[model samples]
Target: MTMKKEYRVKKNTDFQAAFKKGKSFANRQFVVYSLKKPEQKHFRIGLSVSKKLGNAVMRNQIKRYIRQAFLEMENEIQNEYDYIIIARKPVTEMGLQEIKKSLTHVLKLSKVLKA
Candidate 1:
């Protein structure tokens, strides 16, 4: 399933807010920053894959994998938080399952997944 637009963290201001105030959780493949906003009804997710990691195609591939993983785990995720997933160098070589595992680990560390 595709992630809905409203569930995406699309603005620079939102990214800045999350970055400035969010708590972080990291693994070998990803670093996730989370900011809880209890007033919102759903989670908002942002992804960052830098040019330093790879070329455009490689970056987009990682993003697709992340989105798919997030989509699969959306129901288990806690509501009202903004999540930013930053890809690490190792992430470029990882497959979807590995990415999912890393994402899950970070989410749990940040307490953004429902118990």
Candidate 2:
């Protein structure tokens, strides 16, 4: 299943806002930038997988894994923020479960994921 459009952060301005004003947290595989948006009723996420990581297929795979992770963890994640997730080189060596673990670590560091 795909994430709903309301849960995606699609605009360049939105990504930039998160980068500029949000608090950031990082682990070996990912960087998470989170900005609280009290007016928003649900969380929204933007993903960044650089070309340096891989070609289109690999990048898309990484994105799919991330979206899936978020979908699975939706109930545990806070719903009043905007999040920008940036993939790191190390993520290229990981599988879906590893990716989810790494992402969960970063989100925890940011205190956005409930214990």
Candidate 3:
């Protein structure tokens, strides 16, 4: 499925706001930061894969996997938050299922998953 622009957290200010004001949860492979934005009409997601994880190729691979994972849960997500998913080093070796599992686990911990 395609990720529409409305579903993306696109600004530096948005990233910084999530980091500064959002609640965070972590698992083995991912750190999730979420800020509740009640006025927003949709969930906006930002993916962050640091250089510490790898070189350009590896980082892109991890990002692609994360985007795919988020897409899987897109329809089931609530529309009141902005979420930032940060990939840790171990995530570099994880496949799609692992990524999806980690994302779901974190979102559940943060109570972002829709009923």
Candidate 4:
């Protein structure tokens, strides 16, 4: 049997602890939040494609595309941060390059690129 990897931002009590815990940023297409983990040696990410984007098909398509975009960026991100990508409504009209570009831009904003 095989198990899938788990990559979700956990619950924390302090919002300040959370914000100081990580940096976040948003653009027209998406919002990204990231935190540095003391124990993790590799980076893991979660994607949030909200209902506001569209129906199931549109949401899933964006999720898949973003996941792929993240995969392409795995080498560039810091291993200590657990990344979360939240999709905005505008993302539905964008292509993979736009998605990838957004992901890269947000990472830079979140300091994940520096991480």
Report the number of the highest-TM-score candidate.
2
Model 4, global lDDT: 0.76
List model 4 lDDT by residue over 1-115, tens digit each.
Answer: 2112654443443224445666789888888777777798787676778898899999999988887887777788888877777899889999999999988987787777845
lDDT preference between candidates 1 and 4, better one: 1
lDDT of 1 by residue, 1-115 (tens): 7889998998999999999999988988888999999999999899999999989999999999999999999899988899998999999889999989889988888887898
With a 3 Å backbone cut-off (N, CA, C), the pairs that clash in candidate 1 are: none
Off by over 4 Å in 1: none
TM-score of 2: 0.97
lDDT of 3 by residue, 1-115 (tens): 7778998888999999999999999998889999999999988889888899889999998888888888888887888999998889899888999989888988898888988
TM-score, one value per model = 0.96, 0.97, 0.93, 0.81
In angstroms, give how far residue 14 of model 1 lies from its true place: 0.4
Candidate 2, 1-115: lDDT as tens digits: 9999999999999999999999999988999999999999999999999999999999999999999999989999999999999999998889989998888888888998876
Report each candidate's C-alpha RMSD, comma-separated, in the order given. Answer: 0.8, 0.8, 1.2, 3.7
Candidate 4 local lDDT, residue 92: 91
Give the distance in Å from residue 27's predicted Cα in candidate 4 to where it truly belongs.
1.1
Give the residue spans of candidate 3 off by over 4 A.
none
lDDT of each: 0.91, 0.94, 0.89, 0.76
